[model samples]
Every structure is written in structure tokens, then in C-alpha cells.
Target: MYRRIRFFLTSVLFLCVATAFCNDKENPDAIIGTWLNATGKGHIQIYKQGNKYFGKLVWLKEPNDEQGNPKVDSKNPNASLKTKPLIGATILRDFVFDDDEWNSGRIYDPQNGKDYKCFLRLKDSKTLLVRGYVGVSLLGRTETWTRIN
Candidate 1:
């Protein structure tokens, strides 16, 4: 009876450890690569900055103005921000992963050069759901980003 009880306890302990390991969040290493805006409105590249992650605009479907001049984000009310357009802009900033989601981050919209609070979650191994919000998270937009690999 003593030997049977000991074996049962050992088996239970091993199962607990195995379950924890298997249910762990997606590996951070899996996120360390280029991803594209599969919606085709724009392209983004995510990279590491120290221990944080950031994403930048690499391409756009509409890269120019109606007159064929380089487009600018004229809608930005900030005088210092209105002059820059969709090129060479850092759109995603200060993203960190925890608890199976990326929180406490911001995404910049090159279309208006405005920054919004952002969060990211993996919908699948190859798809990410990027949420950008202005005030409350209840009022936000989610975009789908596809892994480039």
C-alpha cells in the first residue's frame, strides 16, 4: 500500500509539470521575425529594440498623393507632425509580451501620424490580431497581420 501511494503521487507530480509546460504561451522566439499587413493596406516590420519590440512601415499599397507627389499626413493637427507621411515611419512601439498577449504598447498611424494605445494577440501560429485604440479599449480597431515567413 505504501509503495502504491508513492507511485501515485509521483505520477501526479509529473503530470502537473507536463501540463504547465504544454500550456505555456507561444514562444517569444516565434514572434521574432518579419510580419506583413495581409489586409494589403500597408506593410510592417517588427524588430527588437533592447528587450522591447517595435514595428515600422516598410511598404504601402498607395505610396503617393493624387498628383503623384509623395503623400503626407496632412490630417495631423500637430504642426510638428503634419509634414511627415507614410514612409519611414515607426508605427508600432514599446510592445512587450506577457500572459499570452502583448500589452502596454502603442501603434502609430502613418495615415494621420497619430499614435494609439495598442495590444497584440496571436490568432494562430501565423496570424496576429493587432488592436489600436484612442481612448478606451472598447473603442478600438483590430487589424490582422500575417507572418512573412
Candidate 2:
């Protein structure tokens, strides 16, 4: 009787530990990949840094201006950042994962020179929903991004 009871408890403990290990391994980095923007004009690469996630503009359909110079953050309100190149710019910042969604981030719109509160959700393995809003989320816009692969 003693051996049977001990074995049962040990089996339960092992199952609990295994379940936790498996859950932790289940795609915590699922969003780490390059995604094409909704307009099909640009690509953003999302990567994890520490416990936070960030995204940067990796490519653009038109990387150069009419003068053949690389595109820059020309519309930026900050004069110091005006000359910063659009490609490789960190457009998404400080996103934390919570319950399968990324929240508490900011998305920078270089075209309008504005920043908005943002959240990212993966609708499927290939589709990501990006929402950027001001004041309230209902007033903002959501864009669908497709996985590059």
C-alpha cells in the first residue's frame, strides 16, 4: 500500500512538470518572423528582445525618392530624425506578450509623422492583425499583415 501511494504521487508530480514544460515550449516566439504590410508595399521584421518584442521596416516597394536618394523619415516632426532612413527604422516598440496577444506598444507612422498605441494579434499562422489607435482603440485602424514565408 505504501509503495502504491508513493508511486501515484510521483506519477502525478511528473505529469504536472511535463505539462508545464510542454506549455512553455508551445510557440512563445510564434510572432518572430518577417511580415508584409497590408498595402503590400513594405515588409516588417518582428523579433524578440529580452521579454519584449519589436518590429522594424526591412524593405519598401520604393526605397528611393525621385532624386534616387534612399527614402528617409522626411515627415518626422523631430528635425533630428528627419534624415533617418525609413528602411531598418524601428517602427514598432516595447510590445509585451499577454494571453497570446502583444500589447502596450507604439507604432510609428513615418508617412504622417505620428505615433499611436498599438497591439498585435495573430489571427492565424500566416495572418497578423495590427491595430494602432489614439485615445481609444475603437478610433484607430487595424491592418492585416501576412507572413513572408
Compared with the true structure, what per-residue lDDT tens digits does model 2 show for residues 78-131? 999999999999999999888878999999999899999999988877888999
Q: Candidate 1's residue-wise lDDT over 1-149, tens digit each?
A: 99999999999999999877654255654465667785677768888888788887777778888899777767766777677876666778898887788879998776565789999888776788889998899899998888876
Query: Residue 144 deviation, candidate 1, in Å?
Result: 1.3
lDDT at residue 132 of model 2 (Cα atoms): 100
The lDDT of each candidate is 0.78, 0.92
Count backbone clashes in candidate 2.
0
- TM-score, each model? 0.72, 0.82
- Could you say which candidate leads in TM-score? 2
- Which residue pairs collide, candidate 1? none
